[model samples]
Target chain A: MSLISQEVPAFDTRVPAYLQRLERAMDALLPPAGTDPDRLHQAMRYACDGGKHLRALMVYATGETLGVAPECLDPAACAVELIHAYSLVHDDLPGMDNDDLRRGRPTVHKAFDIATAILVGDALQTLAFEALANAGAIDAEQKVRMIRSLAHASGSLGMVGGQAVDMASENLTLNIGQLESLHARKTGALILVTCQLAGIAARAPEQVRHALDRYGRCIGLAFQIQDDVLDQIADTATLGKTAGKDQVQNKSTFPSLLGLEQAQHRANALFDEARDAARSISGDAEPLLWLADHIQQRDH
Target chain B: MSLISQEVPAFDTRVPAYLQRLERAMDALLPPAGTDPDRLHQAMRYACDGGKHLRALMVYATGETLGVAPECLDPAACAVELIHAYSLVHDDLPGMDNDDLRRGRPTVHKAFDIATAILVGDALQTLAFEALANAGAIDAEQKVRMIRSLAHASGSLGMVGGQAVDMASENLTLNIGQLESLHARKTGALILVTCQLAGIAARAPEQVRHALDRYGRCIGLAFQIQDDVLDQIADTATLGKTAGKDQVQNKSTFPSLLGLEQAQHRANALFDEARDAARSISGDAEPLLWLADHIQQRDH
Candidate 1:
């Protein structure tokens, strides 16, 4: 069965437009082809070519909820997506996951040489911070805070640290608690940062920020659990990646430990929690609420 | 003849004190060795373990010349050194330069696994910007500029981009101009940023900033030429790295394009220009002047 065939919830009418805006903003932000070091630039664009843009959506959704203008949120959207793309490129490298495919296309290291892929990932990571620093909409103080937040979430104590743990635990059996911590850092940190960045952008009040944090945490875990469920039930074509990769690599996942039915239930519970968190903020949080449902119901 | 046996310049009386301060600061700034993801953090510290710290010294010297206190400059100094260390770790990976020895010891990948080394480099790069963002001395505006400057210098258009070009140019003969451009981006960009950062910290006048820039450019080129010369003359033990790896990899160096004698003479000339640039500034530029001489005279 196709994973996309699952019953998906209706998204906000503004989502398609937001996605288009994000694509355009990202294209404009990246160095154009035929630039010097054309090969590296080309590879970077390739790595970022296609994705669901869920993270970018979160940024826009949170910003809109906090009453920030869409244009003002563009840089954060682009920056988070760039960071996501770079992480995928590195994660798919031969020395890492040794994956040959990503997003239904040959991985960067597969299309280009390993060296070019490495450089592409490194350069893309650098550009993420560059984008945030150059973001003119925010004041200098906000830019500094944004940079610090992104860096803290992306560094050894966050995504990279989680990756190190993930790599180390490839063959070892991890308990449910350990797995949660792993995915929290490996995938949740970046997602959570998207919300924090929006808060920074809108100068969100303390209560709003706290509510957004809760919403982010709930949805972040829900997103990962859904991923684990999809990996188990979906085929490679449906997932657009190497399905069952976690199982094949003997990496313990949510479904692996909790069983497929329980994992799905867990995701649904998290979605409810995420919705409640968003409700705590008395404003236009419709998009964030819609994304929580989308994350739970969407196949891939 | 051993490169270290050559007549080296006498050091400044404060050089040792500065080095000690830098070492302590870097140690404190980095995560403790016992931190989680112990292996990756260990590799990061290992890569940063020991070096001449010429880059950090440049930051301190320039800031001091511009009347910025040493304590105020510590973050920039540490940040640049971390970036330098991360670059070296990545460059020494099996897929890139394939180097096994660095700083008279096994490279990060050699001591740890390839995967761990890659994570170490990625995490360390992230931490560099984090350090700059969290730097307490500078105001938010200065911090943003510093982050942007460092990111621009370290990105594809700068260090990473130059590395990509260098890898592509391997086994292909490059003229002196090509080599200069390559080294300017690869090695010189970070060095130049050290001085630029000092200017940013001090909020130096336009003229002082321009002179410091010229000084940085001259010293950057001179430093690379001296590296090329030392690579040709020094053995593995004296150079503290695989001295002839460039030749073995069929890579071109300054002495390869220009004759050894011409390379040495060119370095001396650049050193003179750098000294003059420092003298143009209206302050006690003694440290900058001494560094110029040191670049020309030092073997490694």
Candidate 2:
């Protein structure tokens, strides 16, 4: 054998593979674009397409660390991405954030009518559970467990709860603790569940699962802080969405409360914590470690 | 036992019992009114609180015919009602039907802000799946099946699909067949799933399940026709919603497409079909039989 290394790079090399698998899985799960109720199906596909697929990456990463097969993770990765996509569609509605653009393109309600956007969001959410339940490779009991985890993470006490608080927080100031709690539920819950789902699918030991959970929690908060920092520093063109929306909406953010330098420092500290948690796991954790560093340093 | 009839009437006696069970079960499932996301939890409860409980009764009626205990059917009953409640919340949004009143109270969007209303609907839908997945009495395999069935009935090809078509159909004329197809998916899918859920819960034989499915489909269509008939003839006070809004919105309804008398005649024919299907089942099908007549003959 040659002295040169043959192994692929840790994280970047696998992202496109995971994203391609996720796209195929999600496309299969979604109703075809030209089917009856064509507009809704088309909008559902539109909303799900072209995302960064970060949450799905988390699912694949966690599953990979546990030695679970990628096909077993496909349904779950698709499910979380669908949930994320639906949330975005609803969040962009006129009564909510009223965002006209997303990912450098018109938002769902802008591309389609408001009624179709609402239905698209609703259908996408339903399709998430449907995908999980129909996952043939996963056992029935495990499927139930994943469904329960996802629904709990997405429901009133989870993501939607966070959105409610976030909407209420506009024009009102929130302290650091309150803000963390809000982010923990809003964006953090789904991110955390991405790890939990893979752990459940793999039937990982409780100790390993707990460590993975901790890594997920740390990474989730760090990801949000990075988003806040990017929202302040990045332009609309680079971000692919309107920048400085937090300040414009009067929504509190890490930089708004902690200052730019302090927010960056806090995110770095959390990244360290996430890396340490990843190290505590027993398997191939390099992907998770790289993911933490990558998420923390992403400009968008 | 005395010579005089000792048994309570079949359907009438069980109606109040089923409604009470539904109320208690739903109350247990919902977050308290003053929870962290207080507005959303409150609105979800408000949307679920005062419906006619017809859907829940269908679960009970079907389960009773299958010899499944009422408690065994509670989660499924609660789930269908939750789905129905979420549909109404979304359907009444400003961009959708825009109705201000439902069941004699202000619609969710009218009672709360539009953002909260949307989140309430989202959270409620999640809770429906959560309830099924967490149902203590249900086996995991059966839970997965129920989730699959519920999600299919609620997703793009089902209730939401119908809504999409209905939204697109505004100011457009449709044939009688087209109107039936729309209502069948819109109102009929969830109604059909209510029986399918109870059947799954009981593990009823396929032949019996098919009869129940047929009964549900017939009743579902008949129920929508009755709604259209009431929308034409009933006043706003009695109907507990805007009267004759279908004609005003220029959406084609059974009564609008066919004559009022013809629509009633179609509904009567469907009710007869439903009764026949219900009677073909071998058990205490009195409840299903009673439901068909009660739905047919009732006035708002």
Candidate 3:
């Protein structure tokens, strides 16, 4: 993450605090009881926290820039994180990516049983929509929009679609174009939805929503490419998670295709293009500008 | 079922026709296309269709009894089916019930892979909200209510929560009370939502909505009890699917907790209670009467 080198951007005053608030909001809205509440809640804490949280930050930042009251996006912010957490949980399942580690501790399936992992993932996915619908003070329609966007991003034609491609890729070699197509769904969909959800949370115009979504698509993969590059360059402690697991698995990846140097160059170029894309399409916004910078500069 | 003596009483001419329309609408609203059309669509189809039409009928009946045009409830009817379909897809996952057979055919995982089955379930869950949001020509508030009920039923406190209990019961002996709690979330949450949704579709008074929801919870458990009994009584050929697998697996179901005779008696008393529950809440309506009679006697 090129952006990881930029001193963490002086810690956005509102974002980290808002992220905490949103996390609590989400936890409160979930089932009060379940299969080993202590374990599930503990795993949820690790999975949700301890990240740079570029996605949640983007949603909050854009909503701030658009003049929407910070409180107005509580539902939206919680909804996005719920989706993000759910994706991670499912991605590590036995029949899926089958990874054993995440963040630091064992992956969800490893920490809990696979059955608990699946249900926990399912509950989180559903809790996201519940968070949207039960966001305390938001009107029902806004909650509906928030939940729908979160669902669309996490469902088919989005993150899950991308995972399907990534899973299938184990069985076939892919050209650069196919690789990008696969990443578009897996990595790009949520990132783009991040932009759209932020804009929608602000009640921004449809044009604004569409433009930020476009920005999300271009930069999301660049983020992934940088991730690929960093995996080769960075260690586990540096990245805050396991690195080079993708190569070990022989999965098609950005570094595998473009070479380390080429992938890095592509990420830098895409970041610049993303900045231009936002400016050209939706005029300009400082949050998006910083977003491009954040994606390109992160170290982890 | 102990209540199997009842018949599908002849109803007014418009009733069946109204139900047919709702079935078409519900089917049309579901199976929304994903980027990968083949796998996602087939999984969607397998997950969604061939239900008993009980949910859709409830909406139409509630509307008819309340003097609302039958079409007024179509959107809500469609939404309930979507929620039901999504739950079935998730419940059939490898980590959950692990059933390879559903509705007399191979489960979605058997037809596709486990990952596709998961995606299909996730997508259908999201599509339920999407359908509520886009249901043709419905009021904003109506849309909101439909979204609320769908989310509640699909979330942790409902179907998914019920599933956790069922899964945990594999190594434990559950008494009748525990069985009821398990089915309450697994089956009753959505059934209650179904009646609530129908009452909402008719724009019934708050009291009417409350009453029908009461009816829903009653029938929901009765339906599940009869389900457990039918697995013992109905042949695989007649059930169009595997039966008696529950006992063979040592699963703690109602019939297992109490013997077959006691379970049958309990189911019959519940059926009468459900009918009384409906009557206690509503004026004479042929459709609700027919619904109670039909559910109590169904063979499949």
Q: Write the per-residue lDDT of candidate 1 for residues A1-300, one digit (tens) a residue.
A: 567467534448789889999999888888897787899999999999988999999999898878898887988999899889988988888789999989999999999989998889898889999998998788999888898999999998899999999999988999999998988899999999999999999999898889999999888898999888888889999788999888889989898899988998998998999999998985446778888877777877
User: What shift in Å separates residue A41 of candidate 1 from its native position after superposition?
Assistant: 0.9
Query: Where does model 1 exceed 4 Å of error?
Result: A1-11, B1-11
Candidate 2 per-residue C-alpha lDDT over B94-183 given as tens digits, one digit per residue, 9 for 90 to 100: 999999999999999988989999999999999999999999887999999999999999999999999999999989999988998998
Q: Cα RMSD to native, each candidate?
A: 6.3, 2.5, 5.6
- lDDT tens digits, residue span A1-300, model 2: 595566757777888888888888887888789999898999998998786888999999889888899999999999999999999999999999999889889999999889999999999999999999999899999999999999999999999999999999999999999999999999999999999999999999999989988998999899999999999999999998999999999989999999999999999999999999998995458888878877877888
Per-residue lDDT of B76-174 in model 3, one digit per residue for the tens? 777677777777766777787777777778888888898877777777776677677666666767777777777778566677767766776776888
TM-score of each: 0.96, 0.97, 0.89
Strongest candidate by TM-score: 2
Candidate ranking (lDDT, best to worst): 2, 1, 3
For candidate 2, list the clashing residue pairs, or say none: none
The TM-scores of chain A alone, one per candidate, are: 0.95, 0.96, 0.87
Q: For model 1, give the interface RMSD.
A: 0.6
Model 1 TM-score, all chains together? 0.96
Q: What is the lDDT of residue B292 in candidate 1?
A: 83
lDDT at residue A232 of model 1 (Cα atoms): 85
- Residue B172 of model 3, lDDT score: 82
Docking class of 3: acceptable
